[model samples]
Target: MNDPTRAPQRVQVAIIGAGPGGSVAATTLAEAGHDVLLIEAGPHLPVDSAPHFRRDEMMQKYCNGGITPSFALSTSMAYLEGCCVGGGSEINRGLYQRTPDTVVETWRRDFHVDGITCETMVPHFEACEAVARVSPLRAPAPPSSLRLQEGANRLGWRCAEVPRLVTYDDKPSGKKQSMSATFLPRFLAAGGGLMPDTRVHRLRRIGGRWSISGTRRGRTLDIEADTIFVAGGAIRTPALLKRSGIRRHVGGSLRFHPMVKVVAQFPEEINLPGMPDPVHSVKEFEPRFSMGCSISAPPLLALTMAEHPDHMTEVDRHWRHMALYYVQSTGGIGSVHNVPGFRDPLVRVQFSRSDMAELAEGLKRLCECLFAAGAVTIYPGISGGVVLRTTGGVRGLPDTLRGNRATLSALHLFATCPMGERGDRCAVDSFGKVHGVDDLYLADASLLPSPTVVNPQGSVMAIAHRNALHFLERAAHGAAKPRSSDGRTLIARSNL
Candidate 1:
């Protein structure tokens, strides 16, 4: 799949990004006999050499060492995404879920997104799951996850095991179903071409074909393709489109699930590396908020504790008993923009006062649940929030949570290049095709018109699969044939 030795070549399709969306699209199109070039901005690390420590993973695969923050006026929330071949699928905790029916309904009714409903998207989701190996736990739930389940049951709130994209084999450490492990291999086997460590500097429409110029290994590279699939996530996709001068309603309407994290000290050792993330979630407060345990990797635990220097001694004393969890709630607008001469785009997220109040309530409820499950002490990961040792202290949390004292982050991001029937407002149409640009498509989380209110990997992959099928059908029927300015076929175009 990787041919760094090859100088330059033209292809029928150029997919910019090797994440789930790009991997799926490349595999599908290549299997259907299209000459596909899959480009990724980061170096490809072998799965066997992938690091286990969170800090090591961040330094290795994450963008900006996992410290990319929004340009907020006051407290900016850090947005975590990957810059490697597999993208977020490689670094994420493997929580795989279908987009909520309500979210799809809203997109259809409000945004006029066609052919994307719970019923219509199921087949695509199922197909994606089969390829990604989405499944339930093979071993028992981790102690931290069980504690969350116990607390939720005590409060009579709903909780369920989250299906993950992992290939379990009775061992504690299962192989993660990242794009590199799943679809990339299939794509490569199907004769798809991959060009890693390549960044697309500019994109131009040269007649009926798209011209792409970029740097690879400190050398210039170029390619011209009949079609371009920009699957470079929500943040980077809009930046690329804007840099390419296709700035019609792009980079607007961004949204994310802003999360507030906490470190809970229980009676037993709960910070187990074998199970880092919680397998369960308290979804009783659906659509608005949710509570789940984080992967209690020591590096992340240390990082969270570092925010509160006074509590470091206590944290270090009982690090084994500490478990990390978070309250993820919906929030308002966030945007991505391109700046000339800058490799990364500027990101800004605007959180409202009401959103802060709701997040405080969520943290309070989470503290109550943890105390019910026999937590001894809880240290809220906020700037000036005090440590709570009793249920009374947990009840008085609202007084301390003044929004300014909170240390928040955004884990899931979307809506930069939303799909809609409104030509003046949306970047892409319902079939994932860019408005006013023929054969240019977006198949990543950027295509989502709004928040899915859940982990979005399944939805992103399903949408990409569905859209790839759409492109396949169009190509089969000669509907996607490139034509000249005079409406004649561009038959002189040569194939690689």
Candidate 2:
């Protein structure tokens, strides 16, 4: 598999994006004895580098496709997305959550996603759990998670420990970067091929097959494959498809888990990341989209916390001590659409007025939790605020939160290439197949119809895994009678 000069090893299937969906799809197809080629648009950066999680790595991996993508009246903050071999799996914080039962029920009932239920989806979840090596945190920060627990416990709000998908070495100090280091190697090992630093500019359908024309090393590569799987995350997947002229609700209905991080500076050198003892995490804000605070200690990244004083003084004493806390918007869903006359497409994500208000409330609550957990000082992390010491400080937040892009960073961007029974508007069907196009499928977060209230990697992997199983089965049957399987006859169980 390491033979680089193998003369363009053609595979039965070509996949884009090396995140959980694409990687898992490759593995599933390969296991079923099909040839799968995994192509990524970026280099594979080593995760062993110090401050590897910093903004420097972010700039290298993200889509700088200019005109910082945002919703209506949003402040200008640079978004971050990993553009490496393993994609976001290499860059994500390794959290795993299945779509909640209620969430799945909503899709089945309200959203018209047929044949979907938590019970029906469980096997695929099990399969993904097996492949991705889902596990609990190696160490739990009771102190940190406890602060959140105390709040929920007092308020009688239910919370639980966050579940994750990660693999640990026995020396096993803590949760390891599971996706790139764990699952990707298996994909590479399973006779799957990888092409890095290659961009899939667009796709063209010629005759009966797909011709994906892109560039590499200043030369053009027009690849023809029997099957193509588009897993280019939420944004790029639809954008690429739309660019290739497969535009039928491909880029509309974009959803993002817009996050605002709050920083708390501790007394000692608590800002240091990756402790010696294997430490796990807590779910103080679980089942409702709030995460804990930590000091996985990146001095360079910790500097983003000019959160206090909102002035030069905090920047001068950058790394004294800092920990990060994040607030996710549960009340919002955004959109992405094509923009003419620009290299980068337009992504418009408008927070509901209620959503923005909830976001502000979450930040205030998180700040309170941090202080309760022993923060020497509490910085609201919003732009233009000196510091908010009391909960009352957040009441007048609309005035402070305006025009100061300091509180923005990207954690999860999802739901562009959505799947549903609603054709002509949704990108893919429940089986992960494209609506209008034949033999084209998308198996990533791109297929998610909306943002999951929690980390979406697990659900994405699970759903795609389930769908892949059925897709392969139907394909196998369809391939047996090639001329007859016009996709209309092989209806997905979800479709039925």
Query: TM-score winner among the candidates?
Result: 1
Compute the lDDT of residue 484 as modeled in candidate 2: 26
Please provide, for model 2 over 1-496, each residue's C-alpha lDDT reduced to its tens digit, 9 standing for 90 to 100: 2432223434467888877788788778767766666777877666543244655656765566212546556643335566776677766666667888877876676556768998999888887777667666566543444555554555554556665555565646544544566666776666666777668888888888777877765567666677889988887898899888887877777766666776656665454345432122334554345755443344433444555434435534644455556666555556666678765666665555555666676676666655555666666557666465555554555522434434665557777777888865577887788886887999898887777777778888887787778778887788421232232211111000
- Count clashing pairs, candidate 2: 8
Q: Worst 10-residue stretch by lDDT in candidate 2?
A: 487-496
Q: Which residue pairs show backbone clashes in model 2?
A: 61-83, 71-349, 139-279, 139-280, 140-280, 173-278, 273-296, 273-297
lDDT of each: 0.82, 0.64
Task: Tell me the spans in candidate 2 whose CA falls farther than 4 Å from its real position.
Answer: 1-10, 45-51, 59-71, 75-78, 140-159, 175-177, 267-269, 276-289, 294-303, 307-321, 337-343, 391-396, 399-406, 479-496
lDDT, candidate 1, 47-162, per-residue tens = 54556545777887788888786787765788888888888888887898899999989999988988778999999998888888977887788898999999999999999999
lDDT of 1: 0.82
Off by over 4 Å in 1: 1-6, 170-172, 275-277, 399-403, 482-496
Ten contiguous residues with the weakest lDDT in model 1: 487-496
Candidate 1 C-alpha error for residue 323, in Å: 0.7
lDDT of 2 at 351: 54
